[model samples]
Target: MLEIKELRAGYGEAEILKGISLTVKPGEIHGIMGPNGHGKSTMSKILIGHPAYTVTGGGVTFNGKNLLEMPPEKRALEGMFLAYQYPVEIPGVNNAEFLRMAYNEKRKHEKLEPVDPLDFDELLNAKMKFLNMDSRFKERAVNEGFSGGEKKKNEILQMALLEPKVAILDEIDSGLDIDALKVVAEGVNKLAGPGNSLLIITHYPRILQYIKPHHVHVLIRGNIVRSGGMDLAEELETTGYDSYLKGK
Candidate 1:
């Protein structure tokens, strides 16, 4: 339900994405594989309307609406979610309160009434349980003092609560241990269905092993060099990106 065409964007005067194009259909899981600084995360940031980057060219549409026109909060309200590579720690905000506020805002966007805190607590507890997270996490500040895995899990927890139509996970696999990866992947798998889509961006194929993307793409030097099925990821494991990087 997301379409990006000839998309070009970068920080300040340097462009990192050059004519990148891709489509994410409903219920599809697309994996974006690439080395560091090759525009994978840049693509995610642009999609989520990060203000630091400017769109110098091309267009992005979500469910037939002009995504580039929407502000970051509007993007989130419109079902665009980005699980950050490094989830920031908000030391003063209560984790549960922050989540409830966000959830309520989405509800308000839909002209629905905000949920009662008690009701929200029940819902949050259920989601945390599914992710195998401790209830004490709700009491702490957001991502404050959390381990790498915990921060990543918190991101997934947000995803679960929001249930966005298209979730762009930017390096969600980074800093996660094997056990944490499995839990996070399992949560993603559980969330996947016919109504939602996922764009998973990562440098390695380990996360792809669990997520099982319907399509795999190799993005290098600001462009997508190749697109294929899961086999591409398997090949990448053995062959690496040397062949693709040769002339680029």
Candidate 2:
């Protein structure tokens, strides 16, 4: 439910995303595979309205609305979620408190009443159990003392709670072990339904092995050079991005 066309964006004067275009239909899981130094993460940030990058050209539409015109908070409220590559820690805020605030904010945008703390606890606990996360984590500071896996799991928990229409996960698999990776992937797989979509931006195909994206794209030097099915990921696993970059 998101369409991007020839989006050129960058920090300051140096352009990173040059003519990037992709469309994610409802309920489709699209994987973006690329090497470092490219504009993979930059594109994700731009989509979510991160102020660090400026959109110099082109456009993005989410669910038929002009995404480029919305602010960052408006983007999230409009059903766009970005799971960061490096989840930051907020020491003073309890994980549950932070989540509840975010969850209620989205609900408010939907013209719904705020969820009571008691009801929110029950809802949060259910998601925690489903994600196989310990309930004790709810009482801790947000990502303050969590392990790398725990931090990623927390991100998924946020996704499950928010239930955005289009979720863009940038390197969610980084720093995760095999078991942690499976748990995170499984949580993501469970979140996929008829009403939402996922854009998984990752370099390695290992996470794709579990998530099994419906489409895979190879991005090199700020441009999507090739697009294919899961086989493209497997091929990249064997051939690397070098072959794809040769003629680009």
Candidate 3:
């Protein structure tokens, strides 16, 4: 479980998240809907300990541990995963190798032995097959020449391999086609269970159509303005964010 309270963070001297608070309990899927540049991604970055942003106030805890105290790699080892809005391309790194390295690091964190390459291959292949991805993906450089959909799929693949306790998907729906969206969403749904939680941040409700979040939140101007069930997302689809933006 993850708990964020009165979190105030921003880049440099400009503040973006103004005392926002949210809690993600185990087995729950929470959708955070908001317009662009209004702190949705900022929240994700801060949660994962992105150094560019400074936490001027508030606190975050993961499974009762102080999350803000952990470094980014420590955060990942602690089961905090962020699927970025724009997944960076690491041209020189083999996709499979990078994945294996990351997966093994987590194992090492758990005081488990690293898996053999052959065994890891079997594991990676099974995950890729479930995502409907081709085996050739293993040979390609990480997101180097992948399409937008492929990059998003790769992010999901990482999620599957890591099995984080809490996964924060920052704009996972961005740049995905309908087919890609379905595949990605289905993969995500398959990974959800009673032991893990998801925080899906997006501007639109289309992905929620497939993921079916347990709770929906409307964020505007760096703060969560409303929280409800799927009905709030349905209403957002029809009325848009005009009502929330009127006074701002």
Compute each candidate's TM-score over C-alphas: 0.99, 0.98, 0.99
The number of clashing residue pairs in model 1 is 0
Cα displacement (Å) at residue 72, model 1: 0.3
Point out the worst 10-residue segment of candidate 3 by lDDT.
239-248
Candidate 1 colliding pairs: none
Per-residue CA lDDT of model 3 for 1-248, tens digit only, reads: 89999999999999999999999999999999988888999999999999999999999999999999999999999999999889999999999999999999999999999999999999999999999999989999999999988999999999999999999998898899898899999999999999999999999998899999999998898899999999999999999998899976
1-248 per-residue lDDT for model 1 (tens digits): 89999999999999999999999999999999989989999999999888899999999999999999999999999999988889999989999999999999999999999999999999999999999999999999999999999999999999999999999888888899898999999999999999999999999998999999999999999999999999999999999888988976
Q: Which runs of model 3 end up more than 4 angstroms from their true locations? A: none
Clashing residue pairs in candidate 3, if any? none
Query: lDDT at 167 for candidate 3?
Result: 96
lDDT per prediction? 0.95, 0.93, 0.95
